[model samples]
Each structure stands twice: as C-alpha cells, then as structure tokens.
Target: MGVDGSDRGEGAGQLLADGEAQISLRQAEIAAAADALRAGGLVLLPTETVYGLGADAANPAAVAAIFEAKGRPRFNPLIAHVADLETAARIAQLDDRAYALARAFWPGPLTIVAPIRDANAVCDLARAGLDTVAIRVPGHPVSHAVLEAFGGAVVAPSANRSGRPSPTTFADAVAETGDKAAAALDGGPCAVGLESTVVSVLEGQPRLLRPGAVTRVQLQQIVGPLAEADDDAKRSPGRLALHYAPDAPVRINAKAPEAGEAYLAFGGGAGGERVFNLSPTGDLAEAAANLFSFLRAADRTKPSAIAVAPIPEDGLGEAINDRLRRAAGFIG
Candidate 1:
C-alpha cells in the first residue's frame, strides 16, 4: 500500500536514518506521519507515557510490521490509540465501568480493555485474536493531532525493542525503531515517563492488568476495589515476566550503591557522579517521570548493576516499584 494506492519509493524498513526520520510537530509533518500510517507503514509518535510505534489498527500487514520491527510477542496484545472516546467506542464495547474510567481518564494515560465492539476496526493480529481489545486516548497534543489526521484507530505499543524500557525521549525512540518507521514525530521528552495503567472491564469486576502513570488509587476511586489480573493478564500488553529492562541487571530496594553499581536514589540522600536520584525531593510524580530516562542513563555508564533506592508502594510509587520489579525479572 502507498499514497493514494500508489507505491512509496521504498518500504518502511528501507526508510532513512534516525536523524532523517525525526519530524517536528508542524502541520505538514503531522500530515506526513498520518499519510505513512494510511499506507500501511509504522510511525513513531509521542504519548504522555512514552513514545509508541504506531500502525493502522485495521491494517493487518501494517500491524504485523510493528511486531516484527520490535520483536514483540504476538501473544501480548497491543493498545489501540484513538483521538477521542467516540472513535474508541467503534473498537471496544465499553460498559458502565469502562465509560466511567474513560470519562475520568480518556485523553490521558489510562488504557481500558473491553469486549470487542467492531471487529473490523482493529485487526486480529493487533488484538492477538482475543475477544477483548485494549484502547486509550493519549493526552499528548502531537499524538492527538496525528490520530485526528489519520482519521482512524492506530495500534501503538512502546517504540522500544520488545522487553526493553520504553523510550521517554525522542532520541531513544529513534535509536530503538526509527529505521523501521516511515516517519517520527518529535514531541521532546514525555511528561509521564511510564506506560499507561491497563485495566480490563470485560469481566464482571474491573481488573488492573498493568500499572503505570495512572495509580491504583486513582483508578479505585472510579471502579471501586479493582481486581488483580489473573488469566486476564493475557489480554494486556507489558504483562511479560521480564519487561522494561536495561542492558545491565537491576537491583531493587538497595540502601546504597555497591562498589560497581549505579545508584537510582528515590529521595535526595545519595550523591556522587555515579548516583542518579529519581527525585531530589522524594516526589513520586517526579520520580515516575524520571524513571526510564534515569534507567537508560545509568545503563549507559556500563555499570555491573543498577541499584535502586526503596520507593514507597503508594500512589505513583506503586507503578514505579512495579516497573523496578519487572526490570529485575522478579514478577510479571
């Protein structure tokens, strides 16, 4: 597929280098990125959580390309990103709980998985052939513009290669999958550096599949005593045993850095060249935004391991600790 059904000069995989793929948030660039998606090509765009590798949700070949490019497991479903709640309804059969959550968190960093409404809106491969589909309305202006320009649902997973940390900065996104995308939107650094909190409303009770910028407490207020993901975990992405990992191993809840370990401090207690504080003031929101970038930076130092300071398991800290536990391959 190509522009107006005409062939593009090259396949998406043969696109230019990362530098050339980076596009600004100007109108022309956004239109070009949308065009790429229409022609069955991947587009790397920003979201409130992290940069996502996007493909037309309805295009089977285009969706397949995303899995191939990222080496992502097909069993792990992808989230269909839409511009508005109206578009989201076309793909997911949202119930009362889903609508309640969406009304409170749509156009933000919360993903709701519901029974499939319009099967044609999102392809089987994108949903991993499940009856449920994960959908979200991103808060980032750049991604919102692209979605409107594209005029349909776009299934986007984290732009990083399979199980690695999601790219919070545009540079890291380009480094991960820029070569495979037809175009990329540069939205600078993401504000919410974690992935969206995934919740499934398909069953009788709402379930939290994965944690992210949206805290459990925030979701609990809307849905009331959310259930934990059991077999339903297969309906969500980022549920793998090992995820958001860096090149070096990670050690969580460490008091201080070891001889060769890089310290990821929570409160501003540690100092030194090797130590990277998540937040100088012990702010959970600040730590959440700084999590992935700090992990990437600490990994670049080539330390034997990355030791993380204890983060309170409340509100946003819950999401942060979840990521750390996954990074250390402790829990799924």
Candidate 2:
C-alpha cells in the first residue's frame, strides 16, 4: 500500500529509501510501532483526523510518557483508539445510544465517552482518574493497523505539543514529536484533518463535548438533539481556554489584512506570502483540512498577528470557527 493508503506504484520503494513515508512499511511499521507501544514506548502515527502520539492505554507508565512528551496537563484526559467496536465495548460500557452512534460512525472520526467497564483496560492516569473513558475507532489505515497489531486499546492525542495547533501532515507530525517517539508510521496527510467529534453518553442525554470532523447535524440525526458540555462533563480533552494556539495573536472576522499580518482568507480575496486561502470557493470541508496547517505556516513568518475571514456557523463551519475562536483566545 502507498503512504496515502492507496495502492503502491513503481516509486513506492523509493519513498522508504528517501526517508519519506515507506510505502512497503505498512505491515512492518505497524508491527514495529505496536511492539514499541507494548514495551511502553511512544509512537508517532497518523490518523484520518490528525497525527497522534500513541501509547499503550493499559500501561500507566506508557500513558504518562504521552503526557510528558506533549507537556499535556495531567488533568486533561486522553482518548483510547481501538481497532474495532468489539474492542471498544470491552473497555467501555456501551448503552443503546452509544452503540447506535458507534455503529454509525465507528471506523471513522467520532469518539464516544462512556462509563468504564474494565478499569484496567485503560489506566487511571490516562483517564485522569475519571470513572468515564473516552474511546474511538480511528479510520486511518495505518493507525487501525497498529491497533490491530497491538491487540488492545491505545491512547493517542494529537502528536503536537500541548496548546499548539494539531499536526495534519506527516512532516508537521515529525517536526512536532518525532524526537520523542520510538517509531513512526507516516500515512501521508490526514483525510479528515481535524480531531474526532467527542460525545459523552454517561448521562440521560448525549452531550457534545468537542466538535470536529463530525458535525452536530450529522450526530443529531443519529442521537437526537445534543446537549452542550457542562461543568461536570470535564472528562473530555481540548477544553483549555487558550488551546490550539500559535505564537502570534489571532484576529478573526477580518475584512482585510494589515501591512504586517498574515491573512487566512476563506472565499477568495487575498494573496502574497502571508496570505493563505482555506478554500478558494468557500468550502467548509476544505477550510477545515487547511486550518491548522495554514496556521502553522502563517506563524512561521513571525507576523504581528494572524487575521481570519469570517466563517459561517453551520454544519462543519461550527467546528472550524470553534478552533478559530480558541486560537484567538476567545473561547474555551
């Protein structure tokens, strides 16, 4: 298979030799990555959403390594990535609602938070000592292959350091956390290019903890009207007020960029080195896929601040604007 999860071609072998993604390394790299995780080592692997820094979910020491590597707060919880729904059921108690959502979105980018059925399956440190556990079945071929090879749950958060934009490309993932990993499997760029939509089903009605590739509209169609995350529902990650931020200050809803500001345009009214169009034709999905990558690129220029065009608040736009607001230090 190719690094992008497609069929390998003539130049496939050269990818590994040139230190790019190894087209033939799917099975070999997955095996090595799983071995590292089983031995309490960190592995940088790709997911459809973003690159993740992964460790054995059951190993407290391994889980701690992830926290230390990312400089993530101990209070923030981690999500366990499983190969299939069956594996998720073993660790988390799935009610009818959780099962319904899982059946519809598993092997995709939707995380379900539920009561812990087997506390030992995911360590207390990984769960932040909460009775609830957040679990997801990632759709990325390389990540799924590693989970299948590891034969258990793995806690994988975005590979980048805490409070930074998530890594979407293989190069960005490696630049962020490659030094701390024992192995890495580059699956090229992420398809979804955003984190999983997290929903907590521990109470009467499912609440949306964090938005991502899976929109509220899509989730509501499966589980009825969703509730917002309350104070007690702090079991999910990405809750920091100033999270997913870059070094430069972010200014949203800008009509035009100033002399020294980097511009993140949506519809098609910007140009030059500092200007990056999320989507030339105003497509939300394309905008989301380019969000973090463009943010990182703009930050590299050391601009005074980054100016963003206004994004509508419907469908995937909610998730995109959610990250933008957080980047600008306006939302939690």
Candidate 3:
C-alpha cells in the first residue's frame, strides 16, 4: 500500500486496519526495528499495558533522544525494558527481596528500581545518577521479541510526550513520536492503558514509586505490609501533583446533590446532567478502563470543568482516586 501523504513519514499513508490483530509483521520487519534500537534510533513497540518509545538504555544519546522526542522532563527517569529476569538482573543491582518480587511479578506490570553497578555502560541520564534504574520484564510477545533480538536493555517511557495521555495503539504512538521514530509496531489496543506500577527496591524497604496495574495490596502480598510514602514525601519521577491529567480540570463528587455537575456514577445516571455511569452498579474494573478515554472525550465538550462521582476507597478504587486526585490538582 502507498504511504499516507501526511508529513509523519514515508509510510504515514498506509490504511489502518480496525480491530484487526493481523497488524503482525514479518520477522525481517521486527529485525529492522531491533536494528534501529541498536543503532540509537527510537522504535515505538507494544506492551501489555501501553505502547512505549524505546531506545538503547546504555547509549546516553539514544536515551536522550527519547526524552527529546517525548519532551519529557530531565528529572523524570525512564524504565528499562528487558526480556527476562536474567536480563533485568544484569542491568540493575537486585537484592533478595527484589528477586522474590520479580519471581512473582516479572512478566507483568510491575517495575522495580535497583542500584546500577555500571552506570557508565548505561546512559548516565538513564539512571539520573541515583545509582538505581527502574526495570521491567514485559509479558507482551512483541516487546519481548524485540528486546531479545536487540540484545540489550531498551529504555522506554510512554510513547506520548510529557503530560499527555499514553498511547494504547499504533496510531496514538505515531501521533506522539511523529517521523522521529523509525517505526511503530501496531499490536492492537493495550489491555491496560496505564503505565506499570513502579517500586524502589534499592532501599531495604520496598517503596511504592508509582501505582499501576499492580496494586499496593498485591505488592504487600508478594512482600509484606509495604509502607506508603508520606504526603510530604519528596516526589519521585512521574509522581507529580497534577500528572496524568487531561487538559480540562476534574472535580470529584463527594456526595450526590440536586444539581450543577456532570456525573460519572457507579451505574445508571441520576438524570438532568451530562452523566457518565463509570460503572452503573459499582464495577471498579470497568470504571478503571474507561477513566482516561472518558477524560479525553469529556475534554472535547469543553465543559467549564469536569466532576467525577466518588468511588470506593479500597482496591482499584485507590488507583482511580489517585489519578482523579492528581487530575484535580490536590497536592496532599
């Protein structure tokens, strides 16, 4: 097929097949994508969660390219993607606790930071010189295949530029990285639209750096009674007060009142407002999946602002609240 006439790149014009998994490629194309990574170019690849803009973590210039491409902040570190536990350990200094956690959650949406033994080998910027690196062993076949072919760790952040919604599909990735990325491997919509949960294991205690598909309770089950960071705790990379927010402001519904706000209810609408039943009948899983997409769509209406109904405080509700609280710009 002819490339699209868009300014994005040579293949920008190819028609996008809808809901089709045949977007799968030949082995040569995959190898070419891997070659791009080894040669210090960016490639947008799929993960079980979201698509990521990837470059060689060991090459500072390549890693910097990711920051530049995404317009990401220097303070916000990137996660290193590996194919397996052995590769993850090779890149980061893992302790026994970290090993135990990895054994339980290595091929899933959990990232752990461990000290870097050879910071020089990896881009100094990749670690932010903290002696630790955030690393994950992805479960997605395409990502694992590419990482294994590349024969080195790839530093990746969400394909979108800083402060934007993450890319869950190839088109979203291309829209974010433009022609700068060599290729974007489309692997269908991401199962989880959010980034991975990040934990710091460099310290003796496992600290929750960022919440993602892996819940705090799940982590505690793997380890034991993980400590929550204090409200006053200094923010780490990706833990900003107003992060993962849409362009429009968000408000949480503390109680059902008579009027004056759009409702994202547990189930059926209360009526007389632009109501979005996040999950009528209180289904948190459905609500979580719909959160970002709904936020994106709601922003289009350009409402004076958005108001969200309250969700339970436990389970996935914690994650929903966490995102909503940030969207509302609550510092505490």
What is candidate 2's TM-score against the reference? 0.93
- Candidate 3 lDDT over residue span 1-332, tens digit each: 01111111111112222211332544676788899998889998887667789999999999888888878878777788887788887777888889987877767677887778657546678876566778887766677668878888888788877876676667767877857798667766665556777777755567887776678887888788776665312324567677666666677754553244455566665544466666776877677766766666666666666778877877767767877887788752
lDDT on C-alpha atoms for all candidate structures: 0.85, 0.85, 0.70
Ranking by lDDT: 1, 2, 3
Candidate 1 residues 1-332, lDDT tens each?
10100001121112211212332427798899999999999999987788999999999999999999999988889999998889998778988888888878766788899999998899999999999999998777678778989999999999999989999988999999999999988777877788988999976789999987777887888889988998899998987879999999999999988999999998866898889999999999889888999999999999999999999998888789989999999884
TM-score of each: 0.92, 0.93, 0.84
- Enumerate clash totals for all models, in the order shown: 0, 0, 7
2 against 3, candidate with superior lDDT? 2
State how far residue 92 of model 1 sits from its true place (Å).
0.9
Where model 3 places Cα greater than 4 Å from the true spot, the runs are 1-25, 230-236, 254-263, 270-275
Winning model by TM-score:
2
* Candidate 1 vs. true structure, TM-score: 0.92
lDDT for each residue of candidate 2 in 1-332, tens digit (9 for 90 to 100): 32332111112122223423443455676788899999999999887788999999999999999899999999999999998889999999999999998877766778899999999999999999999999998766677778888999999999999999999998998899999999987777776677888999977779999998778988898899988999645788987878889999999999889989999999976678899999999999889888999999999999999999999899888888888888889764
